[model samples]
Target: MSASTSAPANSAPVAHNALPPPSTSSAARSSRIAPHSHIKGLGLSPEGFANLDTAGFIGQNNAREACGVVVDLVKSRKFSGRALLLAGAPGTGKTALALAISHELGAKVPFCPMVGSEVYSTEVKKTEVLAEVFRRAIGLRIKETKEVYEGEVTELTPSESENPLSGYGKTVSHVIVGLKTVKGTKQLRLDPSIYEAILKEKIVVGDVIYVEANTGAVKRVGRSDAYASSYDLESETYVPLPKGDVHKRKELVQDVTLGDLDAANARPQGGQDIMSVMGSLVKSGRTEVTDKLRREVNKVVKSYVDQGVAEVVPGVVFIDEVHMLDIECFTYLNALLESPMAPTVIFATNRGNALVRGTTDVISPHGIPVDLLDRCLIVKTDSYTREQVSKVVQLRANVEGLKFGDGVLDKLAGEGEKSSLRYALQLLTPASILASLAGRTQIDIDDISEMNELFLDAKTSASMISESGAAFGS
Candidate 1:
């Protein structure tokens, strides 16, 4: 796929213009082709049969259209090497849509949310190290077959000179001290004693070794050179030298104060900090906090790098209540999003224009300029309709493994306008548990009545009275 080009700053949304209806023959042919070409793993048949009951589902047409746009961008290779953003209100399913797209792409998705403390805690040096680490991690070398060659070492030279003995004879002694290679290999000549020592040490043909000259200097001499015809008859091949060893990358290492690191590490090992935890729940229904936790998760996920593991799905970072994120966290996000493998970010908030009033200041605080926001596609999530609420209730009931009578869903859906899908799900959980306790096979109208009563009882009478008074007053 070609790299993504910059889109127009003020381009209008693509209009799905009217087209002539397909002919009967063409419709039949198209039906046999595929369901939705963009949506993968939905398990829909070629005729586009979806098991999801769409009777009560409403207002998702816009969301579906947005998803279609993303799919087209990917299919046309428009988003191949660029970052995209999805901004919306809380509970708008921005994350859900992004995840669906990621599922189709089969790419790695890094969920990074902005937090208050993370901003100032990340140091410049740490950022550099992280950059290098990320590069090495993603650009790991793959083992491949290549032709092997043998060559003679005419002379040995030390890259550094801290002359302990200074003279050429001394340097030569130090350089040739332990030179040894496989028998009959043309390389640096080695003494019989050194050859025997190397053999005893179990040095192999491909193994690299370092030789110390008599002058107290070190030089790399290849063992394979001894087999060359240029080598003296008494000479033996010299083993290749190994590269300098370095420590393995530390998972939890960060450029932050010791106290900050301690505080972060002290958080319950399984999850992230409270804010990020909440953000994750609000964003994408997943939570991970601290570099160590991320590493642990990555370890398990690495096995599915090119497989079906959902952990690697690209462009799926969901940040809820983004207004609450600290400046430092935003800065880190700005930098991270620029990375080629950065996840797609979905930032949701409720304050509307107030949250981003000072765009320049907000961007500057996070090291992201105004241009970044310009690239983000902002989508407003409208409130759910009555019909949508009914559908959500049924979907929730089905998910919780509750069998509800036909009219029971209608009763629950009509409770109040304030009730949302989330509330519906919450209500279903307790209702399902109670039904299980009661040994009931189905959640009939009686079950709904009991749940409603219990839900009412949980609230203070005074609060209920106030709500009633407010409703009447309105």
Candidate 2:
């Protein structure tokens, strides 16, 4: 044997066995295992955490204080159970405060306004829609456990004594065995476990799931309502149960993530479409369906409550030209504020009588119900002072990366008594554009002069030109 082992001179040596190298495709797949690895720990990025000072505004102190109160409530979980309202005139920063709360909570959801005739129209069945909208808005999800039971059979026995009486000592016996069958309904609790599960799975409203019992066939339940209504799932559906079997089993059979606003808005024109639908209804000249419209609006709001989102972060429904709301709409508004989940509402109107009933009602006509008004935090936004207007122009110019010559801000601010923050910003836009066209890196006295000529030449060209010259020292 040893001699034979050395004698294969022409034969090739045995090749050493080894594993093949990994393929490039397999390597690429393994590399992709951490797609989001770069994004980890990016919460509250630096840009998102930037702080802006609101102190330039006159009432900022009051506004900030109010914001602090809301923040405190949220931190204490009080806001999780109740709603808050801020009522004020336009440009008074009511919306700003709402945004601040959302920011403080680190909430990505937006503050959606409850307005438009479609929101109140009967044609839309507003409550259900509103509920759906709220659920969509908050991105709420719900999951439930269901139980099932199986059927069992028992056989009856005949007594030997009865048989003996009839048939001379015949004996008989009956046997009974219990068999478990699948058939029964189970009540599920809306607890933290379900919420955590939903959050973990990223489940949202409008999803469908199968309801299962411990020992029976599974039933399907659709998430037609908001997450808050998950507690009432059993009452809203039907399931079969065996005649004598009562045992039940529960499990999460399936889940489907909902197609909510976030998903919709991810596409082009989603917000535009929503606004168009609501806006057209509001602009409709006829008041024929006002009652039906109001009911629908309330219905939609109720759905928001059912999903727990409304109660957690209620909106501020601002009604511009509020006096135009019909009596029925006003009445509904009053009722809505009383709802546990309805948004805090604010109405703006030039006509005081629209909300008042009698001659003695001398306060501004938009008199909300006393109880509702008591709950409202109201602030009156007054016209800007000359000095305030000047500051606004200067600040706006700076914001545009424009460098104004001495006194040019004063000149722009003195344009007219009606000059406003909006107007100042508008003027800056054009002036900056002209400066760019003129090969200037920054807005200067010349840009303001040109803007003045364009906007106020007819009123006081001489005064404006003189001011411009003085500002430029030309």
Candidate 3:
């Protein structure tokens, strides 16, 4: 027998647009979350800055002064931020000025260098690309706490095969290391190569060891105190001092890009394997950060900064060949610069009265809008003097690790002033090679003269072509 119950007269039918809440079972199951990419190790080196700051930089004093002003403004922490455009002829040190600005910013501020054309991506909107770049320049000072091993190695055993070759099977399976500390002793499984490093370092029983978290490089720190004291003073057997623990909880302050944080937040709360089970539903660069996530990230950043555990470091984005950017990208910059999270943008261009990309309109100075140009602190670079050009050539020769005989550098520098800085520098490599092949240890006057002839020949050929084209047109 079947009994049917009637629905309540006052109850309305369920709407098709309404959906039930996600099942607990579904939440428990693995997710198909997308993988995120991180932006790390994207900063200028101090050494590079030093290179540009050197006397070898030669000339461009006015340009150098402008760079110094920008650096001071960034460091003052009061200046919001502004765009800097370095306008100059090619080989007039436009790129060099931008690099110098980045260097002067130092380690505290992140320096991100990208070309003008890199802002567009088929996979993402131009605005989104700009957003990512803005985020990249803005960093998160993460005070991360991780559980790590820090102790001494008491014993090490390697599992090996008697046969030298195992055609069908794997040999030298794994190595087991016994690490000790004041608290207790722990056994760790290590790779064969790691064990080899321990042996190569002569780390035996009672030696201290630690594993690097980023790289699984087994480092032998030192011998145990008990083993060290047993050896007499000035003994032939050098007993190293006792090392710290190999495994222990660690607190580190690290700089991470906002992009890196966004990628990490994309991971499923349950696990990544669950996402694999969900199939490839999520593709790269498609992960969206919700407002809630932004609040959480901001909270963490603020907490650390308040606690003196971290500090907000401003960043730089140097766009070389800024004229290459289309009008759309250029228009996007106006708002990007004014955003509360804007970075110090340095743009370099050699173009004067050029057509903006994707448009028939020709722009003056640089292919950028006048409004954007007005906002920029323009720094102009001029041609180098003969002596200054010589200094630069000598400086470059030193940088490239090339040895030149007496008077050769001066001759090259004079030639560079006549041709171009780039042409002059380009001659050094071939000249050095020629000198080497001719049984010479260092480049001399003859090498310089020979390279000059080759450069003149190429210049002559280009001129001949231009002349022929003009005659043909007539």
Candidate 4:
């Protein structure tokens, strides 16, 4: 050891193994915690959302404008909370607009995407699913800093041995890494793979390293103190420091999901620490949560926020194909939309005047009930115009890394106007293949026309099979 090496003055090991003092009274030991969180600063700001533009939501101006209004209302918390319905024909950008709105609002609030049909899980009640969705949207992100041991690698040794867990002739190698620090010295037993990582980073005997507290990710931070004189600390000057002070503090941020909170609150007194690990295993909407439990969770959240250990972030619960929900789910939505605790619900559907599922009643516009529809800020997505369709095709082509000629775009736009935008986009791949087969990389009008006929033939065949109710060959 170097003559300058010594323990830090404040490096006395904390009494982490000590037992806690017992409570003297039953009242003191009561597990009940007082409600603390007053929900504030959760409201939206127009200035915070000023940069959010709907330019990415191409082809549907009405839908985009409607979403913009919803965004404004949701951000401002103006209307005491309401559902927004995006009603349109299939492939009319209803889902896109919903996603865009969520993305815009998500910058400040939590934006969680869920499907309507996900509530049908037989493992848990549908109401629980809805409750979890709402809870997840208003969860928190907690960050804590803790001091950790860190040092430069002084010596490394790799040794291989037969794997004890394996019956077969399998082998495993371990690397013993010796580190020198200002605080002291530590030797860590690590896998040989990690030793290779150290070597790959050119980390030799005198390179400083740190281990992340939460993730345990090891990284080379800087060169060692042994070469302090070789390089300048700052402004071409070498400043040497005493050895026993080389340590690092790791900041660990944990985004506590609703599931984690549930697990935490579910534990009995003195078992809260175990819940931290169990929280990651708990899936949202897996079990029914009672109103009492919800209240408890809210209290816990408030307490965490109040103590400055965590901050609550509002989230978006976007349920696409919302018309798939049964009447019972709709009933739940009716009550949820009126509640202040509810997250911003974005529902999108393609149904127009369909029978409400699990009921004899037929509904207008969508399968949704009238009361729920009234609560929703309804937005209708119209079929795309030819110009908009062209732009979308170009955008899609660029996204998919496809090359297309001007004539091809014009042809696709014309076809989209005659049929639907989805059908036009579907034809691009087949047309591209045809173009490639014809010794050309760029999709042209001829390729599109050929693919169009093929699409028509496939559609006709599908209709025939549906009508005949027989196998395709038969």
Best by lDDT: 3
lDDT of 1: 0.44
Each model's TM-score?
0.44, 0.43, 0.66, 0.63
Q: How close is candidate 1 to the true structure, as a TM-score?
A: 0.44
Error of 2 at 171 (Å): 66
| Candidate 2 lDDT by residue in tens digits, 237-308 | 322324333443444422211224223333233255778767756663422223344355446545855764
Q: Per-residue lDDT for 1-474 in model 3, tens only?
A: 000011134543332223433555843664332111111121223422323335335667667776776777877864464688888988887766666566666656777778887767776676666666776888767675665665777768889765556466556668888877776777888787777777788777777767755566666656666665543554324334333554666776788877677668865555468667465455463655664775687677778778877767668888888988887888888888887657778899988888778788655568887778888888899988888788777777766668988898788777777778788887887776666545456787777776655556346678989999999999
Residue 291: error of model 4 in Å? 5.1
* CA error at residue 18 for candidate 2, angstroms: 78
lDDT string for model 1 (22-48, tens) is: 455843542222212223332222343
What is the number of backbone collisions in each predicted candidate, taken in the order shown? 31, 33, 15, 7
- Report lDDT per candidate: 0.44, 0.44, 0.69, 0.68
Considering every candidate listed, which one attains the maximal TM-score?
3
**C-alpha displacement of 379 in model 4, angstroms?**
1.7
Model 3 poorest ten-residue lDDT run = 33-42
Query: After best superposition, candidate 4 residue 114: deviation in angstroms?
Result: 3.3
